[model samples]
Target: MMKKIILHGATNCGSSNFGDFLYGVAVYNYIKENYKDIEVGFYNPSEYFIKYIGDCKISLSKSDMLIYIPGGYFGQSHKSRFIDNAIQFVRFMPVGIKAIFKSIKIGVIGIGAGPIISPFLKYPIKMIGNKAEMISTRDNESYNALKSLGLDNILELSDLILALNIHNLSDTTDQVVDICKKCEGRKLLFVHYNHSLLARDIFARQLDTFVEENPEYQLVVGSDCLLSYDDEYYIEFSKRVKKNCIQFNYDSPFELIALLERVDAVLTCKLHVGVVATMLNKPVVCFAEHPEKTKRYYRQINQPDRCVSLYDTSEEEMLSILKDKIFEKSFVPDEEIDKAKRNFDVLNELINKK
Candidate 1:
């Protein structure tokens, strides 16, 4: 029987991304509810695990399992530098290795992988995938990529964020509620863009045209990331767009969801913003810089057209697509959510074993 488990993910290291934070919370909450007797601790190797690797090993040795919670950790993104990704890999590698050495079960769940161009990144991830007791990816691309790498222990599951019980979240903050109240009559299009200046300028132009043509909709420019640059990007975007836009800054995932609930639709470059909006049954259009994960997610839900290339799609085309998608009916199928919940099944089975 499992007595202790340490949760590891980007969120454990105080990541400002709301989606990462939510992933950590969702996994933690699920374990607390389902594995009531198991002791849970967060292992944030990114911070000091390298410097204190010996101590970390000792701590992890006591644990029965180590769960690598959901996010796109296995791949490279334009948003992050190669060195940053390398550092992340380095930090987690020793932890996983030591856990294996101690016979501690390691599970990598609801992870998104691939577009792993560099052998440097690919090989280490392959090592982890092979060593992991069970590895479940959230997207088809991830599952197939790992499979091609000769890892046979992987399963394709939907994103863990889909399994969230959004209804249990606290009430919308007064500030967000007030903002929604102020824009009462206008259909709010929630907008979050990546930090690329070129992408921002292109998106701004498209949105300007969109609002110019459709005056009934107003833009709510904000971020799913609390990183300073993300805030700066939206603030800059608001200035570039011709239409008046509301700049939103949220402190927690709950606040972000609250704002999402108030919005009519979502247009974002960030993956999880679109994912969360889809979960809320809000129509979403994504400008994917790295399209693999986003495109796979949309395809999984039978809404492939909603995911579009950030760089290749022209302003006119983007404007047209945005107009079409923003008001379109969208819903996450019950089966998809059921599939997402299977992300935890491997761990559940291990915990229940005699």
Candidate 2:
């Protein structure tokens, strides 16, 4: 019988990253709506682990269960360095260890893992996976990665963001609402590019060409990450594209979803932007820099061709794909959303097993 569950992850509680923020929102709402009786608390490992001796320690000590929410926290990618991966593992190790010592059941849901190069890191991660009462991954690649570490009883689940009911969550900004109202007749395409990706000028030129060709369509450039650099990059990119383009200043996840719900389609390098657009039944063409997670997600939804290489794919080809996607009937199947909800089934089962 679980009494309290601490959702531990790099979630919205301490994050400005819209994707992680939405994941935290989705999981929290799910638990509150379904369980009703269980006490829910959020513990952001990235922010709180540094001050582990304070509220972090107290929260974990009192929790009956610690649930690690969805994200690509467990593996190495082009965007994340080996040192980054090591630091993340280090932050999580103490939390997991303390949870075990306190007899708090641990659950990992809809997480992604892979390409763990170091044996030293692998050993400790394996220990946590083996000790976890329930473990599930968002993709098969992640499942295989855990399987390589000899972990068993892992379930494959969809991304938790799919389970989010965007319509139910209100709080759209006046700016976004007004923009949607103004662009009633024109097709709006939500565009987000990773600022760190190489060849910004080239990508900007490609977008300019796409806009020039598609005069009926309007571009709304924005960042999924609310960092200074991302905002700066989009501001500059918006200038270079001498077409119908508006720079979106991200205020909140609710506003982001509101804009996404109104958009005709999404063209982005960020994984969650594509995921959110898909959830809204909007077509998305992903310019993947770190292609693993994005590619895996598209493939999972039976649309592998939508994920394209950011650098390698030609501008003309990208424009063609974007045009096709904009008009096509692309949507996330109802079954996929149903599958994502099952990520919580393990936790529910544990709570029921008096």
Candidate 3:
């Protein structure tokens, strides 16, 4: 019988389109490709919790390889809720519930970044060691952090961004190649615009000045770069920067990969857009809202030189930093990828035997 697998999480609900989609890509590529006898199912834990946890996922666990995802490891805490007293609430009840439910035998895979130092991570780390089959986190620091906590069945894997298949995409690659022909040697820079956010005005205004200052480069926009492509601010930016501007949103993953492969440089506010651009080895300027999480992620990958903060950055500071990083090599290697793959494979064996 084919083993049944379930991917479940509430941290990333439907509204969290990027991370949700990326996790899907990883499952599709990793387990689905390798295990033909495995049948897959996806679930939303928050939705499942509306009724129950163990019952909702019982079918998944009953199979030979039950794949629990992003489990509710961050046990109950008073700080967990917006209520006046969050920690006291979560700590006692959740801890007791977790202790009671620790015996289920199931294959587990955790796909997300780690929280710093707290019960937030501590519980996940504990459950991953106790209840899970294997845990695959987003970066090396997280992997090391979990290991320091005495975690055994864990691995430092690349972000799900690494799992997206860009190889064997000839026709879409041709489209990207055709797009590249316009400015094969010249740099193609992307600027994000949106009115829903506070910094869009500042970013767009700076971009206008930037375009006038540097006629040598072309500008572009990627999907979700703005809340809407036709938002007034973006529309004006697009109009003023028309001649060499491209606003692209390809629904197909293959086409998007091919499109991004041709870019020389990218300055992005969207999280996955920056991450995916970095994955393609395109020079990236991460104009993050806080740059807190983004910097942590970049540092985890050993690409700090390519990261910059928008927290207190002036237009001039951003422009200068953009120029400096644009020409540098920021590629994650095949060796690193191989290591992640090895860890993933070994984890499967451990889970099966257990």
Candidate 4:
């Protein structure tokens, strides 16, 4: 009989919307492509139990397995606090922390699968998933995170991109154009400063000054800045000068890929853009957002310095850097990209296991 399963990594926190958008799409795609006939469903905790899950009878109905990304089934970790972070650390700590309490039974008899992406959960939650017929994760970070939590869910080395494709936005040229018109000029460059960088206005002012002199290049705003924005922002940002620089948002990564191919270069705050640009061998600069995350990716392969950081993120400095990279010519190699693709291929096979 086809087993009923649930992949329930969802939250009611600040960025849960983004997580929902990303993982929801991934899980749905996995179901569509691989587990075609199986009965599958997804639910946030509230939907799962309909009430606070404290000794409730209806909440006991179990699924064959529960696949999750961290920070969903449980609550979020503390943002930047000592006590909160401590509680979060333990709650999300590896399964071994709880394993010491052997009196608590842990196994996958009635429960089926529970592959988790992050290192937080009840030990039985992870143990059951690990004992399931199959399990996997996309990135190495997630794998290490799980291992640290005392669960070796196996590093699938795939990317969330397995569920996201960009070409779907080709027909949305008008949307792209509407966004691009916000900033316009030959040799135009798009600069997306990371939120952690807090240098958007600083960079914007620098670009503003550079555009005043170098009529050849106009620094365009990227789509990320448009959150909860309206046309008035463009007008307001441009009111001080004759007109504002233009900006654009690619409808999808594929469209962004196509745009990157046509552009002189990209100065991005987003990591995915850096990854895609590197994969395409396009000249790009990544402003260091979270120092740790940037440092990690930077070391993954050499040439990551090709993408400059906000510390050195002056417009003049950035322009000079772009000028250099426009010619430096060292993006990621095709072999590395193909390896990632192969990892995803293997991951897909694993997820499809019966």
Candidate 5:
């Protein structure tokens, strides 16, 4: 009999937030490609289970394992007060607890965590960790955060999306494909920034100056997720770029990958945007959003020089970094790939155990 496994994460496939959707897709693809004998499904706790416990109960009846994929949702990092973040931290506790109560094997893959200063979150974190069959964090900071809570059996791994097989995106010629084809030889620059990270007006002026200076390059501004603020921010940034800048968003991970493959480099204030850009072998210049989460990933891959903070650097300084990166040659480190492969290998072993 084929054992059923659920790969749950913040997946809203083709969500405006492209990175989360990619993580979900990467988890799905990893299992399908490596564990052919097992049946797999993807779940988003926020989207699917809040109103449908009965559906979860039915799915859990046949499920042998539950593997939570990568995301920053596990910690108390959202823009909320102590009580609010505390409330959010336990948002998925009912589901995880239900899985544990039923004795279903649980695992976590390439997840992020940090600055979890609150004692209130410790119990639930421990509860989830105690139930996990395998635990692999995407960065050292997250590993340390979880370790601070006494879960020392965790493995540190690269973000799962780095190991994602994005070549699958080229199977069809959708709008993303069409854009890539149309701009085949033109040097493309992809930009994705978060409003929460920096002042949009200042970022826009810097972007405008960068575009004006580099008139030869094509500027494509976009959002990693389609959250209301994402479009609002992107649209605002576009208006500031006196030079022509294209705005685009896709609802398919494959389409996003197809579009990313054609970009020469990426400039962003989001972690996953930088991760996906590096996975595609493009140079990434990042405005550090959260220190531990954003810079730690680059440092793990041995590229700390790529990270800069908007607060610490002027727009000119930021543009200078972008200028250098535009001409810079970049490649993925072999050790990083090996580390990512080991992550899935361990995850697969945990799932296949009798």
Candidate 6:
């Protein structure tokens, strides 16, 4: 039977993070390949609020089904603001209830929990989970978190971006490729977000020290999120290094994947950046803001030693880990990719069930 499916996540948002954008791509591609006859519509969560509550030209209607893409946004709070929490509750609760009323099958994929400072958010999230026909969490911590709230049917699936077929994707532009391949076998990619300014600076100093110590390798900065704070930190880090670090504007996920192929290893604080590197079979040293989420992902791919806690681990420890672990060759097994693909099967089964 054909259905009008409304896929929701951080899609088509101007300020969306690249990692989130990749999740959208993965979900969209999977859906298009599987459900060719279904009418699919996209909704950005940020924009959903604007259209739902504010005066907007576009509006969201009750659909036959709703699929929320996989991402670590369940417990991610911005400033831990009460008003923000209130708005989120109001924004999602009504839709979730409406979905139930309309018998709209709801699915949430590759979502994680934690850093949820507010107790108020627990009920709303639980409500959505209870209403969902299928909930595929990306990591165990997320599964545990959601299970702790009495939601027991969640599947502990890995991140969906791992299922993306990057092997067939086109390479980046010649200019970008040339810049990325400057040092050939000695190119290392660095990616980080601006959640903590102090941590960002600490990484910058460490990167400078690493560059000075290892003159053979060239550091290349990759932007995962297009935030002003991150851009400013990149500039600051480049200046402090006193070396020419090549920075590339990855406007799309394919370009970033191409750049990853050109680099030897990845050192990143962002979750998806590290995941993508591992997908490309490159060694990655991850600085995890939420240790649970990163550890969960690493555990899935059988690389538990790759995740380092930003709070507990020092810069020297991270650099040491990079030297000991990240430089070594790593292989992403075919079984791992198959495991991620199984998540899509779970999604399809839930959606197409009688």
Ranking by lDDT: 1, 2, 5, 6, 3, 4
The list of candidate 3 runs beyond 4 A from truth reads 9-12, 15-19, 44-110, 116-129, 144-152, 163-165, 169-187, 192-199, 224-233, 236-244
Model 1 segments more than 4 A misplaced: 45-58, 78-85
lDDT for 121 (candidate 5): 60
Candidate 5, 1-354: lDDT as tens digits: 337887666653323456666666566666778778877775543342222222322276568888877887667653448776666555545557778889888888887876666665667778888878778988778888888888866998777767756676443446665566555567788877655536466667776777677776777777655465667776667677666666666444455666777788787777877877787778888877655577777788787778777567787887788777756656668777777767777776787677
What C-alpha lDDT values do all the predictions have? 0.77, 0.74, 0.53, 0.45, 0.69, 0.68
Q: Which runs in model 5 stand beyond 4 Å of their true positions? A: 12-16, 33-37, 44-58, 78-80, 171-174, 177-186, 194-199, 228-232
RMSD of each: 4.0, 3.6, 6.6, 8.1, 3.9, 4.2
* Between candidates 2 and 3, the TM-score winner: 2
Better of 1 and 5 by TM-score: 1
Best prediction by TM-score: 1
Query: Taking the tens digit of each residue's C-alpha lDDT, what string does model 6 give over 45-135?
Result: 4442333223211224645777767766567453557877775555444555666677778888777675555656777778778988888
Q: Write the per-residue lDDT of candidate 1 for residues 1-354, one digit (tens) a residue.
A: 788888777744545667777787677767778878987767753333223122332157778888888888788765567787777676556677677778777888888888776666788777777778788889788998888888987888888888878757645888787788778699988877755577678779888888888898888877665555766777678888967888787556677888988789888887888888898899999888767677888999999889888877787787778888888967898888998989878667656755
- Which candidate model has the greater TM-score, 1 or 4? 1
Candidate with better TM-score, 3 vs 6: 6
Comparison by lDDT, 1 against 5, better one: 1
Clashing pairs in 2: none
lDDT of 3: 0.53
Give per-residue CA lDDT, model 2, range 233-317, as digits (tens): 7667767877656778875667788888888878888789888888777888887877877788889898888888776888788
For each candidate, what TM-score against the reference? 0.89, 0.89, 0.70, 0.61, 0.85, 0.86
Provide backbone clash counts, one per model: 0, 0, 10, 13, 7, 0
- What TM value does model 3 have? 0.70
* Lowest summed lDDT window (length 10), candidate 4: 104-113
What's the lDDT for residue 341 in model 6? 76
